[model samples]
Target: MNTHLLMIEDDHRLAQMVAEYLGHNGLQVAHQADGTSGLAQLQSPDTGSLPDLVILDLMLPDMDGLEVCRRIRALPGPAAQVPVLMLTAKGDPMDRIIGLELGADDYLPKPFEPRELLARIRAILRRRGDGGTPAAGQSLRFGSLEIDRDARTVTVGGQVADLTSYQFDLLVTLAERAGRVLTRDQIMEAVRGRELEAFDRSIDVHMGRIRAAIEADPKSPKRILTVRGVGYVFAKQQE
Candidate 1:
């Protein structure tokens, strides 16, 4: 079955181009010009047919794309868990960081190459489907924290962690290499299959989000620790 995608973009010409391009690449695209209607489409009566992924543009006529992304994550059932890739023309790093903090699986700046967009979409889908490069049937446990590799689920103290697809992979990557410090570059390479960009803080933002979900106190994290002037390491033992 072809992957289904919902694009919430206000630019009609751009939307049409993306939809057609993605369509030719084995995706079924549904485009909505406004956030309100796009959200309604996500809440359609046929719950079984929700889009596999959502490509949301930051500029919308009805509402901000960040809000739309939040609403999508707030949706009930499987719809809330749908992967989202944010698109924006903003050059500010904080905008991208905010989008990721709100549960977006990926972010792409506007005026981007359609090929790069396609690659990002494929990477998100691949991670969501296979849990990245981890071995099948693998599981990790530290104190009350449990990670089910094949199932791609994380729970701390018996409570499920609300982690986006990317965050989950990042956690898994760290946990699997517990007790060993990994630089941001290494982490990005392992989780994203790409080198880290210069001064890119996306990984740090994701770590903060993950810590908030699993740590008893995100202010002073216990599971994932920072190494000054280095990188981060997942504690081999959790208290």
Candidate 2:
């Protein structure tokens, strides 16, 4: 079955081009020109089925894309958890950070190549379990931290950690290779199936979010340690 994708973009020409391009790549692309209609489509009962992913443009006639993403995350059940990849024409770093903070799975700046978009889409979907079924009994325990790959859940100190889908996968990537220092490039490649760009801080932001969820003190994280001028490492032994 083809992956379903919803594109909430106001630019008609861009939307059409992206839809057609993604369609040719085995994705079922649905488009809405405004945030209002897009939100309605997501909540509609007769929509048949929810999309596996959302490609959202930051600029919209009705509402800001960040607001749309927040509303989506506030939706009921599975709808709230739908992965979002933000599109922004703005060059502001804050916009990207805000999008990710609001649970967007990824982001791409304007003027990006269609192939990069496809790569990002595939990477997000792969992390969301579209690639293949996770191995059974694939659970990891680091003292108080527990990760259940099959269930896609994580708990710290007997408490469930509220993590976005991307953050959860990032944690798993680190945990699976505990004690090894993974550079930002390696981490992004492993988690997103893409290389890190210079001055890109998305990984750092996501790491902060993940630490906040699992660490007893995010100010001084124990589970994920950062190496100066290097990258991050998951502690081999955790208390």
Point to the candidate with the largest TM-score: 1
lDDT to native, each model: 0.90, 0.90
| Stretches of model 1 off by over 4 angstroms after superposition | 130-134
How much is the lDDT of residue 118 in candidate 2?
94
TM-scores of the candidates are: 0.96, 0.93
Q: How would you encode candidate 1's per-residue C-alpha lDDT over 1-239 as one tens digit per residue?
A: 66889999999999999988988999889999999999999999798779989999988999999999999999988888899999976577888989999999989988899998989999898888832455777789999999987778899888889998889989988998999999999999997888988888999899999999999999999999999888999999887
Model 2 clash pairs are none
lDDT of 1: 0.90
Error of 2 at 74 (Å): 2.1
Task: Show model 2 residue runs off by greater than 4 Å.
Answer: 45-48
Cα displacement (angstroms), candidate 2, residue 43, comes to: 2.5
* TM accuracy, model 2: 0.93
For candidate 2, the lDDT comes to 0.90
Clashes of each: 0, 0
